[model samples]
Target: MRKEAQELYRAEKDKIVLRPFTAKYPKIAPEESYRIQLALIEMKKADGAKVVGKKIGLTSKAMQKMLNVDQPDYGHILDNMVLPDAAVFLAGELIQPKIEPEIAFILDRELTGPGVTPTQVLAATRFVLPALEIIDSRIEGWKIKLCDTIADNASSARVVLGNSPKRVEEFDLKLIGMVLEKNGDIVQTGAGGAVLGHPAVAVAWLANAVGQFGVSLGAGEIVMPGALCAATDVSAGDLLQASFDGLGTVSVRFA
Candidate 1:
């Protein structure tokens, strides 16, 4: 697992793609895959990367259908992965990148669970904000399975967050609408209900999912509840924006 983690870490640093781990180890269980992810995360931390929070992936019907996966995957969010809104990014920084919109939860209290609830999540959350998640697969050709993606940090790459922050009481997250635009054209639209019925439910699911690994959602951490729609391909010179009703908008540019 350490060797596999090393290869993945090197692949990210060198900007190279490799065969999916599942192709090599067909019997790898999801539990073992998460161990590999944790190993890779430890390597990054050794190199000065700080774990900022966590993220849930494949929680939306669109993403699940696109990935052919039925369950959600969890991944750690490194401090470096967080980016400012409206920032310009170099296209070459990642391999086979795609973008998706999410509702981000900024936590004020630690959450641990086997039985975490959405209400508990809201209680611990300090702010709810609009966010864009940039997903990049290290697996060659973006071929991945549940275990493969789990081992690859749920295909996580960069995260761009809007400046607008709202309290949980200020809005109905489950009914909020989101519109995604690429190159000045609307490409996708979805509601918060698309994410496991509600964004907080996704966060609650994450809290319980990672609890088996003895990991807890920490205070002051920014947790992204999963994309509200399917991922969109990105390339050089592409400009993307996502606007959420009542939550303001966030945009990014690829250079």
Candidate 2:
């Protein structure tokens, strides 16, 4: 990445709570994009931020096709991105915000290596919960190239997890049904298969990808597989709820 582009990227990310840049910077090559991402991570670390987990994006075939990418990409979610139940925020607080239903995994053991398997991910997971991922795009109108999105932490904003949790063995997560509701009305529905054929497979892919960067999925961290369905736009006063068949539900109302 050009030093100029790296500096611009960091400046844009640092404004997460203010006026986030909505326009894409100068086009950056893939290697430069990765460099920009590394710079952002280092900047966050300099600010004493701790990476709590990872989020895999574009895992579904539909998303891949929509983004015109052949493979999945992920981003690091810091400890600050996590919000507890009943958390409130303004709809205008984020730029180009969207919400998606997801299944989140809380791991009981560290997972590393390129050889990690889906079965191992399943075995390592301690619990699963219904989750809503608040996705915010730093790029204008959610317009961005794959490299731009990856460099912006995969558009991650905030994550809300449900109160109820289920053990990995208690549910066929690969087949769990999800219904996304806005204003108490169903807007979209999907199953776990929409996520890379199986949610565990997405987790395995994330573990392998992190390994390539000399990192590993640590114990007690939350890992969110890709969304179970397409993202739904949110507006002020919108009451959003994501109901999972057995894992229970999570909801948030925009102010």
Candidate 3:
């Protein structure tokens, strides 16, 4: 079942949007879904994919409620999945894609725990930066339940990280603001608090949750805490930019 699911997803990567797993099978346990996620990622690793970092998703209360899931999910970040600052992402390479402005935590030290605190997350962080997490789901029409999303690697696609990296103490992250623009026009705006009250809160939540599965957030790993607002849709030839109040801006052109 695992290999079949993995091959199904691999074969249909950007070819067809898929039905939710729940729609096609009996209710799946979150643990089972996560196991499938690990298997798929491992398959990618066997194909020479390198682990770069991790991403936390569904951290917002609104997102949780929308998916009817009370807990957050995580996805692995591969070295090849990271685009340079302002890099263009080929629209032809994705299914249905969306973008969200977020704060990324670059860790200075390994963080592992079932009791990791936001303070610990901040203390271990080397710095933070403005980022845009490009999300794409293999799920058809984005009709996904929590298990479906979890099994699909939390719908992660790629990340566009900004250039300027600032120390956590250099600015107040919770009060930081952001303006998201598409094609040079502002389309959405938000503050850091929109991410589980504060962005680091999500990071802390991730460390503790994933740690239960024996995943340790390593030093030098980049952690995407979650989006600050609702995500914006993207299309070919659209240029998207996010400007943070303190952190500089990062842009991506869909081509």
lDDT of 1 by residue, 20-127 (tens): 898899999998999899999999999999999998999998998898899999999999999999999998999999999999999999999889999999999999
**Candidate structures ordered by TM-score, highest first:** 1, 3, 2
Question: What digit string (tens of lDDT, one per residue) describes model 2 on residues 1-255?
Answer: 445335544545554332222233554555556666677777777788888888988888766776567777788778878877556767876766789899999999999979999999999998988898998876555656677667777778889988898998987888999899999899999999999999999999999987887889999999989998878889899989888998888988899
For model 3, the superposed segments whose C-alpha errors exceed 4 Å read: 11-14, 65-69
Of candidate 1, the 10-residue stretch with the lowest lDDT total is: 206-215
Give lDDT tens digits, candidate 3, residues 183-250: 98999888999888999889998898888878899999999998888878899999999999979999
Measured against the true structure, the TM-scores of the candidates, in listed sequence, are 0.98, 0.89, 0.95
TM-score of 2: 0.89
Residue 192 in candidate 3, Cα distance off native in Å:
0.7
lDDT of each: 0.94, 0.81, 0.87
lDDT of 1: 0.94
Candidate 1 lands at a TM-score of: 0.98
**Model number with the top TM-score:** 1
Per-residue lDDT of 39 in model 3: 85
Off by over 4 Å in 2: 2-31
Clash statistics: count for each candidate? 0, 1, 0
